[model samples]
Target: MRARGLALKPYWSALQSSIVSGDDRMLFPPFGNFLVLPSVSPLYVPEDAKPSQEDLQAARGVIMSEAQAFAAEIRSAFVANLVEAHNGARTLDSPLEDVDKLMRLVTSAVPCPSGAYCSTSATFPAILDHFKVCSSAALTASSVSTSPMRVLAIQRVLAAVNEVEPGKVDAAKTLTAELYALGNEAFHCEACLPQQAAVGPAAWSNAHSTKMGWTKMVHHLLVRHTMLGQTLPTVIYTPLKPPSDSGDAAATAETASGGFVVEDAES
Candidate 1:
C-alpha cells in the first residue's frame, strides 16, 4: 500500500533522488523520517485492536482510492493553473517581497526561552526556505512555458505550513481549495476552452490575489505569535542514521546530540 501511494506521483521519486544525492540544500529534515498524523481523528487505530483480514482489506481499498483521487486532483489543478497563468496577460510572480519581510520578522522575533516549545522557530525558517524555492521554481516554469513545477512547489509550501499550524491560516486553505476546484472544473466541463484558450484571466486573478492574501495572513500570525511569546508542544529531534560501515557496522551507532536531542521541527 505504501509503495502504491508513492507510485501515484513523480514528485516523491524526484524528492527521493534529491535526498540520496544530497544535491539540494533545501531538502532538509529528510523526507520519510517525518511522519505526522493527526492526534485526534477517525483514522486512528487502537494498538491492541486486532482487525480481521476483510476489515483490513476494506481499509486498504478506501485509502488507496482516496490517494488516487487526490493525485488526480493535484494533476488537474496543476494543469489548469499553469495554463491560466502562462497564457494570461499578467505574469504570475510569487510574492517575494512579502516573503522577505516575513523572513526578517522571524529573524528578529525573540527565541524561545530555556524550556519552551518555540513553534515559530521550529516551522517558520523551513517554510521560508520553501517559499523561496517555490518562487524560484515558479519563475523558471514561467520562462519555459511548459513546466508544471510551480504547482508542485506551491503545494509543498502549503503542505509544510499546514502540517505545523493547521487552521491558523484559513486563507491559505481557501486558496488550496480554489485551485483544486478550478482544475477539477476545467477537466469535467465540456464548455471549457481548448488548451491555448483555456486561460481564464478572472480565475487566475482571483487565485493570485488569494495567494498574496494568504501570505500576509501567515506573516500576521507570526507577528502575533512573536509578540505574545507563545509556544507550542515541544518536539524532540532524532538524529539521522550514519552510513553503513563495511566492517564494524555495529560501531557506527547513533548518538544523542548534546546529551539530549531537541531541535526545532522542520518540514
Candidate 2:
C-alpha cells in the first residue's frame, strides 16, 4: 500500500494542479482545451470566454470524485487478490476434524524411539510416540523439559486451524463485499473535465453539439492519459525536407545531419 501511494504521487500532483488551477491540461494534456461536437469540424473555445466559477468548481469536484472512485476500485481488486492467495494456501480438510485425529494419535499407544528426536529422520508414528511419552512425563514432573517433537506437532495442528478457520473467511468476505460496493459507486463516473467547463460559452451555444459530448470528452481524456503513461518507443529521427534555396541548402543539410535525439520516456 505504501508503494502504491508512492507510485501515485505524480497522478495526485496532477489532479491537485487541475483542481487548483481549474485547468485540466495538467491531467489531460492533449484534449484539455477541446470539446466533443456532433459536426465534422472540432469545437474550439475562444480565449476571451473563460469558464464560469461554478463550472470550474463542478469540473474539479467531478474529476476528484472519479479519481477517488477509481482508486477505490483498484484497492478492492488488490484486496480480493490477497484474500484469494490466503485462501488458496489452506487445505480443504476441516481443522476440527484434523485436531480430533491428532489428539487421538497422540494418546494412543506407540513405540517410543531411544535417541533424541530428529525432524528429518522421524516419521509421523515416531513423532506421535515421542509426543505421547514426553507429554505424559511433563504432566507429572514439572522439572521435565518440554519436548521439541511435542511442540512441533502442536504447532502444525494449530497452523492448520489458523489458516482454515471459518471466522477468517467470513471476515475476508465482509471486507471484500464492502470494497466491491465501493467499486460499484464509481462504475459510471469518469476522470475528465465536465462538458460545461471543457466547452466555453462559444461552443456551448453552438447547435451542432449533442448530448454525447461528455462521453466523448471522457474517452478523449482516457486516451490521452493512456498515451502519457506509456513509455515512448524508440524511432529513427527523420529530418524534414529543406527549403528550396541554393545558399540555404548546404546549411540545412548540415543541421539536419545531426545524430538521433533520444526522447524521454517519462511524461
Candidate 3:
C-alpha cells in the first residue's frame, strides 16, 4: 500500500522533516564506524510471556550477541579506515560481509525512533523504509559539511550500502524470513504451534549467528561497492607527495646552479 511497497510509517516523522527541509543534515550518521544501540527494535516478546527461564535467557543472549556483533562492525571499520589512511586502499576478500557489518554499525548507533517497525522480516515496505531512513540520515549528515565533494562521496557510499539490487536481495529476503520466523516460533506464536515446534538453545544461537553472518556479508558488499564508487581521483588537482624537501631547497638549488652558495663544513 505504501509507495514503492515500503511500509514507511516507521520513519514518517524523520522522513517528513527531511523532505520539508530538503534534507540538510549530515545524513551518513558518523560513517557507522562503531556499533551502538540497535535502531531496529527486537521482536515483540512480552515481558509477561510465559516462556521458560531458559527461553528468556536465550532471547536475551541473542540480543546481547547481536549488540556485540554490531560493536565489532564499528571496530572493524575503524581499523579499515586506519589501514586505508596508511596503505591507501585494500579490498576485502569478502565484501558482502563488510556491508552487513556497516549496516549493523550504523543501525546500532543511530537508534531509530520507536515508531519504526523493528523486525528483520523482508516486509518489503519495511525494508524500503529502512533505506529511506538511512538515506535521509546520510543526507542530513552530508549537508553540513563545508566540503561538498566529501558530502556527495559519502552520500554515494551510503546509497550503495542501502541499494539492495534486484536478484541479489533474495538472500537478504531469506534472512529476514529466518529472523522473523525464529522470533515467531520462539517468542510470539502460541496458536497453531507444532507440538514439537521448539528449538534448542544451541540451535537458536546458531540461527542467530547465521542471520548475523549473512547480514554482515551483505552489509559489507554494499560498503565495498559504495567505497568503490567513492574512489576519488588520484594525483589530479591534488599534488603528488610534495618534494622530499621543501625547506630552503630553492637556495640549495641556486647554489648548485650558479656555484655561489657555500656548502656546510659538516657536509
> lDDT of all the models against the reference?
0.28, 0.27, 0.28
Instruction: Give me the candidate number with maximum TM-score.
Output: 1
TM-score of 1: 0.21
Q: Which ten residues in a row have the lowest lDDT in candidate 1?
A: 182-191
Per-residue C-alpha lDDT of model 3 across residues 1-267, encoded as one tens digit per residue: 112112222332332344332212212122221112242222222333343445434545444455345434434553344333222322223434443343322212221222223312122122323444343332222121112232232233233323422232222233332222212112211121232245434554533322221122222223332453454311101111232433544434433422222111110
lDDT of 2 by residue, 26-72 (tens): 22211111121111011113333344445444455555655444334
Superior by TM-score: candidate 1 or candidate 3: 1
Q: What is the TM-score of each candidate against the true structure?
A: 0.21, 0.19, 0.19
Show how many residue pairs clash in every candidate, following the order shown.
0, 0, 29
Error in Å for residue 191 of model 3: 69
Pick the winner on lDDT between candidates 2 and 3: 3
Quote the lDDT for 155 in model 1. Answer: 31
